[model samples]
Target: MNKKTKFITIGIIAIFSFTSLFIFSFIFFPNLQTSINSSNDNGRTLQEEVSNITIIIDYSGVKDNEIYSNITLINFNTTVYHAILNCSEIKVQDYG
Candidate 1:
């Protein structure tokens, strides 16, 4: 094929591929704004309803190469739930 014809073919293919990807993402993800609006219609979010939430990290007592953290969720000045998080065998590196 000639140079002009080859360049036109490649440009058409690139445009078609980009348009197809854009259409696919919209069809699969749908609309997020509508979902957020529907949730707000029900009531306030969990954080707004809760009075206080505390997260404690105990790095002084690192055992077995693991760091521990405790999460306390309080509602109306009462402890409602507690969660313990353990990070074992995970190394954090600075990539600066």
Candidate 2:
């Protein structure tokens, strides 16, 4: 092909190769816990059992005003409401 067409074809191939590599890395490596786990499979790590949570609150009397941020961990028994309370200082009337 011409000079310009050849350069364009090379650029497209490079981009495609980069995109494919990025996608495959995630597909194979997956998550941090997987890498940390032992290959022998004696037992699962604590990281695998617990979850990472991030709570965002926006109550500035305006739209999309995220004032408070809380990052905490929760087990199987932890409720969603309790998770939020752990992250922020807010008033909630509980009728139980």
Candidate 3:
């Protein structure tokens, strides 16, 4: 092949490699949230109201491979969380 043709091919290959590198190297993000469940299971009839206890373990810190998690209770159900909080090697910092 001619020197000019070979140089053009090399230049095109270099441009594509550099462009791909530039596109992937700067400020990329991990797509999470797109991974969570979107479907809902109400498990209640139309006349019966839905009952669910949504609790958030807010303000948690882990020490010695154990979690010190806080509970933020959002009650949607008529029933109560009668079960006492239990954990192994728990250091109850504070309950809000």
In terms of TM-score, the best-performing candidate is 1
lDDT of 2: 0.65
Candidate 2: tens digits of C-alpha lDDT, residues 1-96: 999999999999999999998887778776635544566475534432234655667667776755444345556435556667666666978899
TM-score, prediction 1: 0.38
Comparing 2 with 3 on lDDT, the higher-scoring candidate is 2
Rank all candidate structures by their lDDT, best first, as comma-separated numbers. 2, 1, 3
- Ten-residue segment with the worst summed lDDT in candidate 2? 42-51
- Tell me the whole-model lDDT of each prediction, alpha carbons only: 0.53, 0.65, 0.46
Question: What would the C-alpha RMSD of candidate 2 be, to one decimal place?
Answer: 10.0
Best by lDDT: 2
Q: Determine which window of 10 residues in candidate 1 has minimal summed lDDT.
A: 79-88
Provide the lowest-lDDT 10-residue window in model 3.
Answer: 77-86
Question: For residues 5-46, what per-residue lDDT tens digits would candidate 3 score against the true structure?
Answer: 999999999999998777666535334234234453443322
Better of 1 and 2 by lDDT: 2
Q: What are the RMSD figures for all models against the true structure?
A: 9.3, 10.0, 12.1
Candidate 1 lDDT score at position 1: 100
Instruction: Assess candidate 3 and give its TM-score to the true structure.
Output: 0.28
